[model samples]
Target: MPPPPARVPDLTALSLLVAIARTGNVGTAAHEVGLSVQAATARLRTVEQQVGAPVVERERRGRRAGRLTSRGVLLVEWAGPVLDAAADLDAVVAALRPARPGEQPIVLAAGPTAAEGLLPAWLVELRDGPGGQIVLLDTDDPAAAVRAGDATLGIVETVEPLEGLHATTVDTDTLVLVVAPDHPWAGGSGVDAAELVATPLVTRRPGAGTRASVEAALTAAAPDVRAPAPLREVAADTAVRAAVRAGEGPAVLPRRAVTGDLAAGNLAEVPVHGADLGREFRAVWKEGSSPQGTARDLLRIATGGRIR
Candidate 1:
C-alpha cells in the first residue's frame, strides 16, 4: 500500500464541501459552518491546493449561486464516512472526557444503597471542598454503567469481584437480615444459615449489588442448600424497606439502608449464624483509566481522603 497522504483537508473544510454540494450555494454553506464568505473562499482555495484539484466552480454573473465541480462532488462523497467517523469519535471522547479532573458535571453511578444512604453525605462533603456539578445515576448495575462510559465513576456494594475495572474499597458495609418488629425472629435467637437460606425473603430485584451479595453469602454458608427465591423482589431499596416494614418477609440488606428504621423500632436486625454478610463499598472505573479531576476529588471524599 502507498503511504498515507501527508496533508489532507481538515474536517471543517470537508464539511464546507459537503454543505456546498447540498445547498448548491457557496455563501450559505460557508455561513452554515460559521465562516464568512470571503474566508470560506480562501479555505476552499486552500483545500483545492491540498487536494491538487479545483473543487468548486464560482458563481457566474447571471447564476444565483456557485456549485461543486465534479471533483468536489467526489471529494464530498469520500469525506462522508470520514466526517461521520470523526463525529462518532468526538462523541466517545466527550463521554470519556468527564473523568478528567475539571470536567463539568461529573457523572457518577451508584447502587441503590449507596445512592440512598451514602452518596448524599459524600456529595455534601464534595460541595464543601473541591466542588463541581455531579450527575448522579442511581442504578442497580453501576459497574455496567461505568464500563459503558455512561458514568465517570461508580459506587457499588458487592462481594463479587469486578472484572476489567479498577476498583478501590471506599468503605465497608454489612448485609443484615432484618424483619418487622412483630416477626418471630425479631424476638428469638438469630436464625442459622440453613434456615435463613430456606426462607423466602423480600429483596431487591436481580442484578442489584445488595441482592447479589446477600445471595452469595447465603450460598457460601450453605453449599448444599439452594437459597430460596425472594418472597417479593422490588426495584428499589426504599421499596424493599417498605415491603419488609409491611411484614412481607425478611430481607438481607445493607445495614446502612435500614439503620434509621432499626433505630426507630420499625425494623429489627436478625443475626445469621455462620454466615459472613460483609461487603465492601467500592468505587470503580474502567481498567487502566483512573478517576481524575472532580471525580478524583469526589472519590477522595468517598474514601475519607484515602484513594487506593
Candidate 2:
C-alpha cells in the first residue's frame, strides 16, 4: 500500500508571498490581506525558512522588490493552481447550500442614484430574461463589498482603483450645485466656482464621492474663501435632497441624481466655474475573475459597452 499522504503545509504564508510579489510593497500587500506590516514581514520570514531557500529579496520596504529566486517562482507557480481551485470550491459551496437552482444570486454594490435610476431597467430585464438570480446592494462601501466577495460586481463613483479589484469606467460625469427653486440662487443659469462658493453649502459626510468632487472643486475655484460650515452631512442621497429642498443650504449632487428635481422645478442647478468637478462611475470585479454567461451578458447590457 502507498504511504499515507504527508500533511500539507499552511498555504497562507505562500499566498502572502504571492501578494507581496504582485504588489511590490509590504504596506500595499498588507492592506490587501488585512495584515499589519510587522505581521506580514514575520510571515514572509517564516515562509522563507520553511522553503529552505530565499524566495524573495526583500527591499528596505519589505516587499518582494527584488527578483524571485527560481525556487520561489516555482513554489508560487505551483501554489497558483491550488489557490484557484480553492477559490472555485468556495464559490461552488456558496452557490450550493442556501440558494436554489433557479436562483443564482449575485450581489451588486452601487450608489443610490445608480441603484434607483440606472440599475432597475436592466435589473428587471435580467430577472425576467436570461439572468435569473440577483441581489442589489446600494452602498457607498463598494470596495469593501468587492473585497469580501459579497458582491460579484460594484458600480462606484471613483477613479481610484480598488486594491485587488479590476475596474472600468461606465460613465464620466460632473457635480451640479442644487438648491430649492425658491432659494435666492435658484434659476441662475450657472455661476463660477467662486460665486457658487459664496453661498452657504450643505455637504455629505467625508468620503462620499459627490462630496469629494464638490470639495475639490470648491478648494480650487475659491481658494481664498473659507469652506463654509456644512449645514448637513448626511450619508444617503435622499437625505441630502431633503435638506436642500428644505432651504438648509445649497448642495452639490451628481447630475443624474438631480436631473428629475431640476426638470420638476423643485430644484435648480448652480454652476461652479474654473473646475470641471467630474467623476467617473466604475464597475469593479475581482482580479483574474471573469463574470461569464448570464452575468457577463447582463453586464454588457447594463453598461452599454465594456468599461473604457
lDDT of each: 0.82, 0.71
Clash numbers, per candidate? 1, 2
Expressed as tens digits, the lDDT of each residue in 1-308 for candidate 2 is: 23654533356666676776787666777778778878877776777777776777756775556356777677878888888666544433343235556676777777655654456566555655674555666577787898888888888776665889888766677787888888877766677777766666777777666777677777877899776677778876777887888888788888877888888887888766687787777788888898876667668767784543
Model 1, TM vs. native: 0.62
What TM-scores do the predictions have?
A: 0.62, 0.57
Write out the backbone clash pairs for model 2.
192-273, 193-273
Q: Which candidate is the best by lDDT?
A: 1
Mark the regions of model 1 whose C-alpha exceeds 4 Å error after superposition: 1-104, 160-163
